[model samples]
Target: MNQEFKKYQAQTSPHPLGLEISHAKGSYIYDIENNAHLDFVAGVSATPLGHNHPKVIEAIKTQLNKYMHVMVYGEYVQKPAVELAKLLAENLPEPLEQTYLTNSGTEAIEGALKLAKRATGRSEIISAKNAYHGNTMGSMSVMGYEERKQAFRPLLPNVKFITFNNFEDLTNITTKTAAVILETIQGGAGFIFPQKNYLEAVRKRCNEVDALLILDEIQPGFGRTGKLFGFQHYNCIPDILVTGKALGGGMPIGAFTASKALMVLLQENPKLGHITTFGGHPVIAASALATLKEITETNLIYKTLEKEKLFRKLLVHPLIQEIRGKGLMLALIMENADITNQLILRCKDQCLILFWLLFEPKAVRITPPLTITVQEIEQGCQLILSVLNQIKS
Candidate 1:
């Protein structure tokens, strides 16, 4: 199977943590040989309720008995999709009442960019440097890292980059800007949180220019950051709020929300301006709705902070430089990339799933499932510390 995977499947990274999984539940993944691996990365922060969560699975099962994909998105009034959108609006801030669902995070990012451009009638998009929105062309164009994007050059024109959390860089967002897209808590760039008032200042500047603020909550949404959305932490609501990852509860989904007045423009001027065949698939929406209800209704969202405290309290070591980020969205900055790599690979061999940040080589990702218990936190932290000690010895 490993040989077949390497030969048949197209490779993204040269070295992939190819774990042949048999099943998963709660916070652990079982291999084909029945080795129980404690999952710390939570499928890159997608499985908030953990693997094959009963509620999410039951929702999918129930939806399957009724319908799957009746019609392409927006054509048919699917109950799951409509209800999910409505529930999202009920939870989100005002003016972000309407939602456009998509298949994945990247697709949602693309749609949000289009919406911003359509509403503002401007093409210039200001994005933060070292930011990772998504890999799609529209999202990639705004990616601040040059090396990753150099190969995909001649991307969406009029896209510019600015350093995140740098107040001076806020000036680059001018009246000509259509939207300033940013990751509320910049993932893949060491899980960097916005400095004090940085997001607020950006909101002020965008308001001044009448430019839209599109916050990408792909990694930090769905109660991962101790709030329903990461933007809520800073008290600055985005004009267009993009969300995904944990929103699906292990299912694949994405959505962009804005004012009805602003979103209705797509329906009139272009008439199906942004159309997707399987954007709001009924089964996926059902799973998402269940996931959202479980998070908002239960204490899981608030428990994230408590879990985060336990992780911080237990993960202290000399080799660890610093911890960056908030809530479950965290990165441990090792002294160097070598140490980070060693810790991740060694921990994996020890049946603990650890991962690295996309752009930050010296950082290790620690985004576990929000449903993870205190015992799981202690277990994972102990494994991490053991690996660190071995490396130090």
Candidate 2:
């Protein structure tokens, strides 16, 4: 099976850990050998409510019985898709009344970029340095890191990058800019939060230049940051809010939202400027509806602070240089990448799952499901401390 995976899997596989997962529930994933691994990474923060939550499973099954695929997106007004769109419109801030659903975050980013250019009739986009939006050409064009994107040379031109959280860089957003894209909280850059007044400053600058502010809430949305989205913590609203990952509760789904006025641009001036056949897959929409209901209807949204406090209190160690981020979206920065890798490997060897961030080599990720319990937190933390001590010597 491993050989087959390497042979026919398109050859993009990372250094596979080869764990062979069999099943998962709550905060634990079990291997085929029946060994349980306590999950701390939560599939890189994609499983917000945890693996196989009963409600989400029921929602998907219930929708499966009724229908699966009916027609091309935005044509028949499918039940699950319509209901999910309505729920999103009702929950978001004012003027964020229209949602265009897609298959993944990268597609949503592509659609949003097209919408911005169509709405403003401009060609330039500004993204933060070290930013990660997605992998599609349109999305990759704005990615901050050029090293990873170098092989795909000559990306969409007119895409510029600025230092994240730097007030002096606001001048770069001139009238030529159609949109300024940023992550509400930098995910691949090790869960970095916006400095004081940084987002507000960005908002103000965008307004001055008449450029739309696009917040990529893909990783930090869905109650991860103790609010409905990470931008809520910064007290600023984005013109275009892009989301994915946890939105579908383990199923694949992505969506971009804007005001009815802004979204209407995609419907005209070259009618159907952006289109996708599977944008609103019924089963995915149904699963997303269930996930949104769980996040919005329960106190699980506000309890993240207490959960984060518990983690911080118990995670003390001499080797831990700092703990960064808010709510359950956290990173523990160690002394160096070598130690970080050893600790992560040792933790998994001990049957406790931990992970590393993309850009921050010295950082370890701790973004579990919101349904994780206090007992589970203590257990995971204790295991982490033990691994840290072993690595320290």
Candidate 3:
């Protein structure tokens, strides 16, 4: 199966963690040999309720029995999709009421960028340095890291980048700018959090320049952060909010939300300005609605902080420099890139699943499922410390 995966499946990386899976339940994934590996990555924060969650699975199954894709998005009034969008509007702030669902976070980012340009009639899009929105052409064009995007040159023009948390760079956002997009918490940049009213300052600047603020909450949304959304923690709300990853429970989905007036621009002047064939698939919407309801109704969102405290309390070592981020969205910063790589590989060998960040080589990702228990947290941290101790010795 591993050989087939390598040969048949096109891979993003040369060395993939080819773990042949038999099944997964709760916080552990079982290999073909029935080896139970404790999952710390949670499919890179896509599974917030843990593996094969009953509610998500039941929602998917029920929707599958009823129907699947019947028409393109915005054409039919599917119950699951309608309810999901309405519930999102209820939870989000004012003016962020209407939503346009998409296939993934990258697609949502593309839509948001287009909306900003259409609304303001400007083409300049501003982004933060070392920030990662997604990998699609539009999102990649806004990506700050030049090394990864050099090969894919001649991307969307009129995109600029500013240093995140750097107050002085706010001058770059002028009247010519259509939008300034940023991750509420920069994910690929080692889970960096905004410092000292940085987000608020950006909001004020965008307001002053009549530019829209688009916040990409793809990695930090959906109860992974202690709050329902990371922007809630900071006092700044975005003009366009982009979300995905955990939104679909374990399924694939993404969405961009804005004011009714703003989103309506996609309909009339262009007549289906942004259309998707299967953006809001019924099965995926059902799974997402279930996930959102469970997160909001239960204490899972609150427990994320408690679990984070447990992880911090247990994972103290000399080789570990610091842990950055809030709630379940965390990154373990090792002393060097080699140590970070060694720790992740060693943990995997010890039957624990650990992963790495995209741009930060010294950072090991620790975004596990929000449903993970205290015992699971302790178990994962113990394995991490044990590996660190071995590396130290």
lDDT of candidate 3 at residue 219, scale 0 to 100:
97
Candidate 2 C-alpha lDDT tens digits along 257-347: 9999998888778888888888889999989999999999999988888999999999999989999988899999998999899988998
Model 3 C-alpha lDDT per residue in residues 43-159, reported as the tens digit of each score: 999999999999899999999999999998898899999999999999999989999999999999999999999999999999999989999999999999999999999999999
> TM-score per candidate, in order?
0.99, 0.98, 0.99
lDDT of each: 0.93, 0.90, 0.94
lDDT of 2 at 391: 81
Candidate 3 global TM-score: 0.99
* Model 3 / residue 156 / CA error / Å: 0.8
Tens digits of lDDT, candidate 1, 48-116:
999999989999999999988878889888999999999999999898999999999999999999999
The candidate scoring highest on lDDT is 3
Model 3 misplacement above 4 A: none
The predicted structure with the larger lDDT, 2 or 3, is 3
Model 2: lDDT to the true structure: 0.90
Pitting candidate 1 against candidate 2, the one with the higher lDDT is 1
Model 1 per-residue lDDT at 369:
93
- Give the winner by lDDT: 1 or 3: 3
